[model samples]
Target: MTHNLQNDLLVRAAFSRPTERPPVWMMRQAGRFMKEYWDIKNRYSFLEMCKTPEIAADVTMLPVDLLGIDAAILFSDILVTAEAMGGQLSFEQGVGPQFANPVRSRSDAEALQTDVVHKLQYVAEAIKVVKHRLQGSIPLIGFAGAPFTVLSYLVEGGSSKDFKRTKLLLHNEPELAHLILQKIADVTVDYLNMQISAGVDALQLFDSWALALAWDDYEAFAHRYNAYIFSKIDRGGVPVISFCKGSSVFAPLMATAKPDVVSVDWNADLRHVKDGLPEGIAVQGNLDPFVLYADKKVIKAKILQLFERMRGTDGFIFNLGHGIMPDIPFDNVRYAIDIVKEFRY
Candidate 1:
């Protein structure tokens, strides 16, 4: 594990340096595919793994040992923030995260607790554990759900193709929504600051549903809070990467959010993102996740095309536009990593 920290693939990629090889890692790379993760899941339910630092740290490193990616995102879910917030949350295998007690009113929102740092201290401790074990060999990334995204889950009470209730609440009851968003945003900023203090080298903010909002609504609702989270981080040296799903619309806001690195999702055009983004910030992805299922030859060809498209760019990190699905072939996943590693610039 004794490797050059300064030259670490993830570190170089964050700085937009032409790495010795293009740094490669996957979203959800530390997840179910790994036997260690499955073993942990079998031993403990979802919440237990998150709360148990030793177990979470163990899960976080499995992908690091297996795929040997440039970095490790702390093993946890974004919804964990909501659960810590006094929102009652539980997961159903196929259904995803669900909130039993949601905030529909300003009073309900106010009644819920904020400043969950003390509760989420486990996440910070897990990072500490992973860092101690990695011995500074690999960068460990800290992440949190962006405020609006978190608030969306809380208000909608779970996942939704459309956040009509959330949007209606935002529109019909502006003060209540504002109060909720404001509190969540404040917590998010504090939480991320706390994570950085916990020893994470880089950070990512996930706005998984930002695209569903209208353009102006996004500016008023989501963008500012995401900006606030970044503002509290150590920008002087540390790296900050923002990964908002449905990135085409949000690409413009990436400039304002002030992430040192901005990740592009499959729905966005790489060229357009490159064109509109602010200078000095690195770009992280755009490959469709389903590409992992394409035949190996076709997958390799696309990877070569990605390299050519991304070649000579000072600040580019090759990654799937989203996390790899569980059904993907390990061989294809390995092949994709090889292609990313061969991208000299």
Candidate 2:
């Protein structure tokens, strides 16, 4: 599935190999910040956009074409796996994703399906299309939600502020929580492997809600399942990235999973985090997304400051701490990418 890539900076940097400068890409680089995205988004339901290969490839190409990023991440939602696993998933304008039949009791947990890769074939189709569109110009990153985060969505029925139901399930029914987590981990392993088979250049596992758990709970529920998926996947030299909101605190634990890169939030110093990580494990991100809202001068200064701190470091990629917000100025995002691309080590 390899193609002659014009820019292998991302893959090289992911393996901690030397590069001309740190490769630049953001978490949600292809998302709503652009009028071009909304032009297409307005015509389809969010899921419609994700499931259609042509539309998904179109959306996946926006950042690469418009922003000149180092990579293109597949345009899809994490909870699509949940829906394929028998959750009645839905999204509202402001309510986000909701599962009509959430896993509540032991029976509910047991009823969830594990043989779901067949149902997710559209993702593979979309990947093929994205790769064709990329034409070996850059890499395409495939991703899935990490087990605990996907489980939280299934148990809570949607996004939550406190994750009270999820935590209570863990505290009140430890075995049940383990059962659900195992199912998710199994699906994730197969799902990621499917993406690799379909020809993604790299993978990223998003544990968007791992920060919600206490230390012990996180180890038991989050870390173990992520590690299991990492162990089972057939990566075939494709780099895998492990990311969570609390990576600044849990990166050491994350590195133990053997991910090629660990993406951290903006709370920690990028250089300090990189210094702490074991050698050969690359570090991506730690910039505040809100910084894009500042003036171009401020954005340039912040980008330069991060680059200065990371100078002489290998395996570093410049990116925002998290996904871009929808309302961020499109010009500002373009400007930010320009700033990162212009810098040199």
For candidate 1, the lDDT comes to: 0.81
Give candidate 2's TM-score.
0.99
Best by lDDT: 2
> Which has the greatest TM-score?
2
The residue-by-residue lDDT of candidate 2 on 167-213, one tens digit each, is 99999999999999999999999999999999999999999999998
Give Cα-based local distance difference scores for all models. 0.81, 0.93
Quote each prediction's TM-score. Answer: 0.95, 0.99
Question: Could you give candidate 1's per-residue lDDT for residues 303-335 as a string of tens digits?
Answer: 787777776677777788989887777667777
Clashing pairs in 2: none
Off by over 4 Å in 2: 1-3
Worst 10 residues of 1 by lDDT: 1-10
